[model samples]
Target: METSIPPPKRLKMLDATIKRHQYQQDALIEILHRASELFGYLELDLLLYIAHSLKLPPSRVYGVATFYHLFSLAPKGVHNCVVCIGTACYVKGAQVILTCLEKSIQIRAGETTPDGQISLTTARCLGACGIAPAVVFDGTVLGHQNPELVSERIQGWLQNGTN
Candidate 1:
């Protein structure tokens, strides 16, 4: 008798996405987006599977994943907070907001909270320069942010336990 282990359901879904894209190397970015959507974050093993499935070099896949700010190799928390440090935002005091959040949460950029409740990260640009000093909280971009405003928002999350 012969038996084979079945792949995890999520992996199967990722495979389907790859198949839908015809496994074309040029479709890498789209496939990666789907994979990230399905997996929350792209771990090394998942990236390897993708590289192997597309017959591309692991290094190449890794490079692509790392090159894009949208891709995250590490696990994200329930609530995501991304501070934009673009020139416009910086000049508008985005750095001060970021610093306040870090001090309030006791976690640096790219690090998740100890409780896994929030993930703090920074972005080069969110393309909302007109609103400069923008911050993204749980996917909703809030513009013209200040340190006090951000701190209050973080407090609400901490107290309400909401994402």
Candidate 2:
């Protein structure tokens, strides 16, 4: 069974974080970052509360949160696999790696595994063009990635805690 924090507790924590930052409207991005870090994702209620506390329009808050790729409104898994899909990475066959991973885990990109063990996401770029086709697995950037290598890494991460 997974231990989870209640919604009210999460809201309180976010409120505290906002208060600590003085609830400045200009601190919206930072507030969202802290919220996502604490709750794993920003739910609708949290978004609304943030907008209300900031004295900003909900649309503005939502737009800012959605405009940035760093903020996630969906739940993430314990492990995250982010494949770079930049021009260099694409030229190096990043899509092949993504497809292979999807086949391996039976979950497409932007989705989490059924067991909630892993999540697969794609990035515009990981800023590793020299070592193109980089994939960030659990925050570790592995460049020069290929389908076979990515598959092996995924399998290893599944069988072991980390790789």
Candidate 3:
């Protein structure tokens, strides 16, 4: 007979969050936010757990998780790079900056590097239009960016290592 291992403490915390929300279906987004906070990313098993707990269909749970860009189905790397491609940033050559990163890192947008050192993604708008062609490196918003500067920053992360 196989013994069952108890779920992680985070799972229990998620349960508390669900309970706090009274399991109302409308609170699905809030529940998911807490789940993601407890877990770095939303694993399939966790989503299923939430669905079962809320008495929601698995499809609905999956749909909500995928619908929002804020949630990540997969784990993120130690360092994260999010580029703003909103009208202001795009018009200022955000695409060129993104392309430079892809070529240098050999990974497309919304993908993490093979070694998991960095995860690259794009945001529709960071609300920093004044600084067009903006990129967020490790949560720090950078403005007036260029391919050379972005490349240099990434190279620095690769060489110096990120926390």
Ranked by lDDT, the better of candidates 2 and 3 is: 3
Q: After the best TM-score superposition of candidate 2, give how far the Cα of residue 119 lies from its true spot, in angstroms.
A: 0.5
Top lDDT hit: 1
Writing each residue's lDDT as its tens digit, candidate 3 over 53-139 gives: 999999999999987767888888889999999999999999999999999999999888989899998988989999888999988
lDDT of 2 by residue, 52-115 (tens): 9999999999998887766777788778999999999999899899888999999988888877
lDDT of each: 0.89, 0.85, 0.89
Residue-level lDDT of model 1, residues 58-105, one tens digit each, is 999999998787888888877899999999999999999999899999
Steric clash pairs (candidate 2): none
User: Per the 3 Å backbone cut-off, how many clashing residue pairs does candidate 2 have?
Assistant: 0
Q: Where is model 3 poorest over a 10-residue stretch in terms of lDDT?
A: 1-10
lDDT at residue 111 of model 1 (Cα atoms): 89
Error at 142, model 3, angstroms: 1.0
> What are the per-model numbers of colliding residue pairs?
0, 0, 0
Model 1 — which ten-residue stretch has the worst lDDT? 1-10
Error of 3 at 154 (Å): 0.7
